[model samples]
Target: MSTKKNNPSALNEKAGISPPEIISSNAIQQIKESRKKQPSSQELIDGILAGNITALSRAITLIESTNSNHLTKANEVINGCLPHANQSIRIGITGVPGVGKSTFIEAFGKYLTSLGKKVAVLAVDPSSTISHGSILGDKTRMEELVKDKNAFIRPSASGETLGGVARKTRETITLCEAYGFDVILIETVGVGQSETAVHSMVDFFLLLKIAGAGDELQGIKRGIMEMADAIVINKADGDYIKKAQLTKVEFNRALHLFPPKKSGWIPTTATCSALTQEGIDGVWQTILDYLELVHSNHYFVEKRKEQNQFWMIETIDEQLKTHFYNQPNIIQLLESTKKAVQNNEISPFAAAQTLLDSYFKK
Candidate 1:
């Protein structure tokens, strides 16, 4: 009886290696239970005010959800959080592809957290028009920063908005501020209208460039440079120091050509290596100097008020568009109108008028 009881359940050790559970079953059950108990808006608000990151993330999810009920709850949360926002500095960082944006943000974010500050990173990644999916590796690439307790890295909220920031980004920012983050970093990885949108909302705009051909004259991104509070050349350590200096001088010259900023602060250029963490602290110092000047004047308050008004108008426009597109009558008419225009049977403008008339019962 003793020998029989000692026998293994598999009966043979050489059959195969039994895979152990990588995650505990109890944890999975707990996750399911928590999902079933979806927190109320007021609970979410309280949790955010208390600096709970999990609650903050869930609140943002509600803001991004397309469901009508979710949107209503999201609006309530925003209104509640609004009173606590505008307490943190909003910074937008932009760079063209291959400029090491993710790596730079990681290094910069880590540096900020080391100063006993809470940092939040929101990346604007426009979804592929064809696939409706965004490249989400940006959050994962920030290995050290993501592990930092005071640093929060959020991947892009996927959708098409007017440009710059996503439609729900402002609400997300309010929630983050209420969660007690000192610095809000908006990373604009997408090209085009995104830059303008971000520039309108952020107190500081930074453009990151790599040391490359100076023949283009930095005029290629002239519009972005004009909006930049500062320009920093990255990858400046490994055999690129001299080239980086040259690029910085070129950017400084280009900056002088633009009209003065409303804040009356001249944009500065510098170089840093994200890998070596060189000059990262100086970048923060430059931002502090800007903050000091802007705060001493009326520009900072005026700019934020303007941004609120701008977003209010934008929200109205987005709602009108969404309402128009969601109507059954308009949806059916749009398909036929598109085919008519493509077949050259109707002028595009005339087709648009037809759709509008149908939408308004004209």
Candidate 2:
């Protein structure tokens, strides 16, 4: 009867089985705006310690900010949360892109929550070095975990540092720990330089790998292999189950070639399917066993202490580099020096020395 012959919307009713809203968006936005209207450090700390997710997210956002203005506030929040942190077991997970890290974390996180444990996931998404852009779609990928009240999934901060781990990630862990999360899972992007950084941060290092995809003997990386506390061959269902098992055997053999771990815990290797939820519980058991061994041998507390010291020196190196590069003269000279070095005008080390000279002169 109308100008339009038919309306597609009239063909179907609303989905009655849609998931329920945990909290209204309007309510959350209103709360955020109110708190953002000049929240004191202690107020944010109070909210975080009281187990308020919004408050926890806001504090983490502040910590990840690069603005100089937020530095003091961020430091205050970290100092406040420090006393309540180090109470949780931090696990770092890394793998190549398309390794199903997101799916695995979601499945693993849900399993932990089912056991009455609070889980916080800091997931990394693919980032571009040229554009400094990230999709940040991990929250969407982890559909079930996002809906679970006992779980918190945060897409790790992107841009600037593309080494898988996020900026100020350790600070974020402290904040999550203070918020009463029992398990903190840090998911890094790749299996390269980032692994070293992530390895030093967590008590347990889990490497997620898939089967029959450029995963041959050549893929055996001794450096990453040595860092791993557990190698989980994911996507182990369907036709690939046998291949996964073979991969597991290969990894187990490769792990044996490495020296013994200081924690007195041998790296565990197993296969699991995130889709079918198979072997998910075994991963948790492996972690518990490692915890028992490390705790009993006194490596738990000592490892954390060593990590703290490492970060202190690392922060100094980072700040010095940032300060050096921020100088007006260094900014002006860097471009010219880059062109000269690219043209074979100066040795790489000499170019570096030149920049250092200019920075010190400034």
Candidate 3:
């Protein structure tokens, strides 16, 4: 006590033990303050245009936020970034579950970055309807791309959206494009109407398939195939090579049965081994060729215009539905109306009319 140790390390030395490093309270306070600080919308837009990954990530989080205040900020950010978007090539990739979508995207994104192209991978993960939560594990699965500075990977929950894509994915794409990403890859939540939703948003749609899965058609709907600009057979290596080739031929034949796409381009089928990085170039080349073909025919611009119009109408419908359901009277009546219909106390059409009338009156 007479010779007081001024430092914890000195006291540890007296006790013949090593001292654990400690952070000061002031340092912790600084960190808390930094985290609590929210950037202005203009700051976010400037950071995004400057290619700041942190700002881009924060902007996306804002877009995904459910809070009304955050949504207002997110809309402001979107408006700021919109002028800089629509410059990148947007590609939608979809397949049945277990079709190696994560693997293929990792390989494809890595290849694109090697060519000096900035790539962004947006993954839509299936969410539990009961919990409304998703695993959000695509970034973990795509380990290599996660380490690459040129590649940005984001995994979003599908929420209640029917198409296996997040409600905010289109806006996210705009933000990615604004960040100067040359290529945008949207991975849908396996197979379903998600393919159609993705097809509506992307410049090119790629359907991934695998062989030796018994069904061969692989549970992929015929409608999804019709939407594809290219069908790629994954796992085309080692013993599966022959099976992949046969699958390619089968897909080509099947694609011929559908009417031609409005793009005036024929859909092609190819094989690739994402594990081996084999034939990845061919797939990219096929996309390039399609781009050239569509641009030459002016289909690319026209398709984008059509997509914009489609989304506008879609937004209106969604808003109207949300407005109708969020009304207090509708929420109170919804369960009772369903019960009445089930009990045959009221006709289904009459129940619907009553609900609509209540909503309009409110």
Q: How do these models rank on TM-score, best leading?
A: 3, 1, 2
C-alpha RMSD in Å of predicted model 1 compared with the true structure: 5.5
User: Against the unseen true structure, what C-alpha lDDT does each candidate score?
Assistant: 0.86, 0.88, 0.91
lDDT of 2 by residue, 8-119 (tens): 5964766675766699889999999986696778989999999999889889889888887998998999999989998998999988988898899999999999999999
lDDT, candidate 3, 233-325, per-residue tens: 999999999999998888888888899888999999999999999999999999999999999999999999999898878778876897798
Candidate 2 runs further than 4 Å off: 1-36, 339-348
Highest-lDDT candidate: 3
Q: How does model 2 fare in lDDT?
A: 0.88
Pick by TM-score: which candidate is best?
A: 3
Worst 10 residues of 1 by lDDT: 213-222
User: Given candidate 3, what's the lDDT at residue 106?
Assistant: 98
Q: How many residue pairs clash in each candidate?
A: 2, 0, 1
TM-score of 3: 0.92
Candidate 1 regions exceeding 4 Å error are: 1-31
> Please, what are the lDDT tens digits per residue for candidate 1 over residues 208-273?
988864474834566787889999999999789999998888888888889999999999999999
lDDT of 2 at 40: 77
